[model samples]
Target: MSPRRRRTEEFTSYYGRPVLKEPTWEALDIAGYIFAGGLAGASSILAAGAQHTGRHRLERAAKLTALTAISASVVALVHDLGRPERFVNMLRVAKPTSPMSVGSWILSVYGPLAGASAAANVLGIFPRAGKAAGIGAGITGSAVATYTAVLVSDTAVPAWHDAHDVMPFVFAGSAAASAGGVAAALAPLAEGGPARRMAIAGAAVETAMSLTMERSGKLSAETFHQGRAGTLLRLSKGFTVGGAVGLALGGRSSRLVSTLSGLSVAAGSALLRFGVFEAGRASTRDPKYVVVPQRERLEQQGRGASDRQGAAAGADSMG
Candidate 1:
C-alpha cells in the first residue's frame, strides 16, 4: 500500500513478499551482461583466427583472450544473480518472458563451444592438438560473434526489441571489427587483407543500421539521443568510421596506423554494446517510452475496429 509499509512488510514473517529500495542496477536483465560477455569472447576467437598458418603466437594470445572473456562472462553472470548458486536452476524450466533464462541458455551453449575451441590452443605445444584447436576455433569463433544479438533482440526494451531485424548484423559487424583489429595487430601486410575487409564490412553495417534506426524508429532511437547514451552512440560511430578508413588504406606498412585503426574499431564496438545497454535501461526508466507508443497502437486498433463495424453495417443494409 505505502512505501514504508511495504518495506516493513517485506522483512515481516509474511511469505512471498518482495523487498523495497530496489538495487540501482541499471534495471538491466542478467541476459544483457551475458550477451556482452559472450560477444567479447566470440570477438577474441575471431581475432585468433586471422592467420591460418605460421602465427602460433598470435593464435595463442587470441586463445587466452577468448578463454578469459568466457570465464569473465560466466563470473559476471553469476554475480548478477540474487541467488548466485541457484543460477543453474534457470535450465530447469525456461520462462520465455525472462530474458535472463534465454541468456542463461545462450551462455551455456557458448561456454562449451568456446572451451572446446580453445582446447587445442591451450595444448599448443602439441602440434597436432593445436591444428585441431584451430579448426574448432573457426566454428566456435563465429558463434561467439553472433548469438548475443538474439539475446538482446528478444527483450522488450524498445531500442533492442525494435531493432531485431538488424541487430544480428550489427553484432556481427562489431565482432568482425574487433576481430579485424586483433588480426591487424598480429598479421603482416599481405595477410592483413581479410582483416581489413572485415573491418570495413563491420563498420559499414554498424553505421548503416545506426543511421537507419535513428531515422525510422523515434522511441527506439531516443535511447541513443538521451544523456550518456548519446555520447557513447556518437563515439561508436566516429571510431567505426575512422578504423574502417584506416583499414581500407592498407594499415600494413605503418604499424602505428594499423594499431590505431584496430584500437579504434575495438573501442567503437565496445561503445556500441555499452551504449545499447544504457539505451535499454533508459527506454524502461520512464513510463512514457513504454506507455505512449503502446497506447497509440491500441488507439489505432480501436479506429480500425470502428471502420470495420461501419463497413459491416453497410454490407447488412445492402443485403
Candidate 2:
C-alpha cells in the first residue's frame, strides 16, 4: 500500500476572493491629481529660488506653472469627489489625523498664495505681499508634493502601506524633477542652469528611492514588478534617467536638447505616480500578498517568543 500523502492547505481567502477591497479611485483623475500637486508644490519652491537669483524668466515661468498646476489639481480632486460641495465640506473641520482633511486645508491655503504670487508677477501689483505669499507657498508646497504618499500609505493597501518608508522620498524627487523640467523647458538657456541641475538631482534621487522600495524583499514589493505596473515603472525609470543624462550632456549648450530632456522628465514623473497607484490597486486583488506577509510576521513573533523561553529555561538550570 502506498503511504497516504498529506494535503497542504493553500494560502487563500474565503470563496477565493481578495482579502481587501480594491480602491475605487479612477486612474486618470487620481493619478493626474498626484502629478499636478507635486508639480505645483515643487515649482513654487523653484520660483522662489529663481526670484532671489534674479532669473526673471525662470521665476515667471515657475510661478505661472505652479498656479496653473494647482488649479487643475483642485479641479480633478473636486471632480473625483463627485461634487464641488464635497470638497468644500472637508474644510469644515480640521483633523490632523486625517490625511484628507489636512490636505484639504493645505490646498485651500496654498491655492490663494500661489494665485497671489502669479497675479503679482503678471499684473505688477502688491510686490511685497506677493513676495511673502510666494515664500509661504514654498513652505507649504513642500508638504503638498509628498503628502499624497502619506495619504496613500496610511491606507490598508499592502503595496502602499509597505512602501511608507521610501514613498515620500520618491514623490518628492518626482516633484522636483517635474518642476525643474518644466522650468528648464520654458525659460531661456542662460536662466536654465539651475533647472537643469535640479532635474538631474531629482531624477537620481527618484530612481534610487524607487529601486530601494522595489528591492525591499517584502511580498508586497512584488506588486510593483508585475503586469501593467511593471511596464509603467520601467518606462518611468528609462525616461527619467535618459532625460537627466540629456540635460547633463547638452542642456547647457543647446536649447532644443534642453526642451526635449525637460519634457521627458515631466512625462517620467507622471508615469511614476500612475505606476505606483496601479501597483497599490493591483495588490488588493491578490490575497497572497496580504495573507503571506501576515503569516510570516506571526511566525517570526512565535519564533522569538520560543527563543526567549528557551533562554530562560537554560538560565534557571544554571542557577
The lDDT of each candidate is: 0.66, 0.92
Off by over 4 Å in 2: 1-10
lDDT tens per residue, model 2, 1-319: 3111111135658899999999999988899999999999999999989888989899899999999999999989988999999999999999999999999999999999999999998899999998888888888999889899899999999999999999999999999999999888999999999899999999999999999999998878988999899999999999999999999999999999999999899989999999999999999998888887787779899999999999999999999
Which model scores highest in lDDT? 2
lDDT of 1 at 236: 90
lDDT of 2 at 42: 96
Strongest candidate by TM-score: 2
Scored against the true structure, residue 98 in model 1 reaches a CA lDDT of 66
Q: What would the C-alpha RMSD of candidate 2 be, to one decimal place?
A: 3.7
Q: TM per model?
A: 0.78, 0.95
In candidate 2, residue 163 scores what lDDT? 95
Clashing residue pairs found in predicted model 1: none
Error of 2 at 100 (Å): 1.7
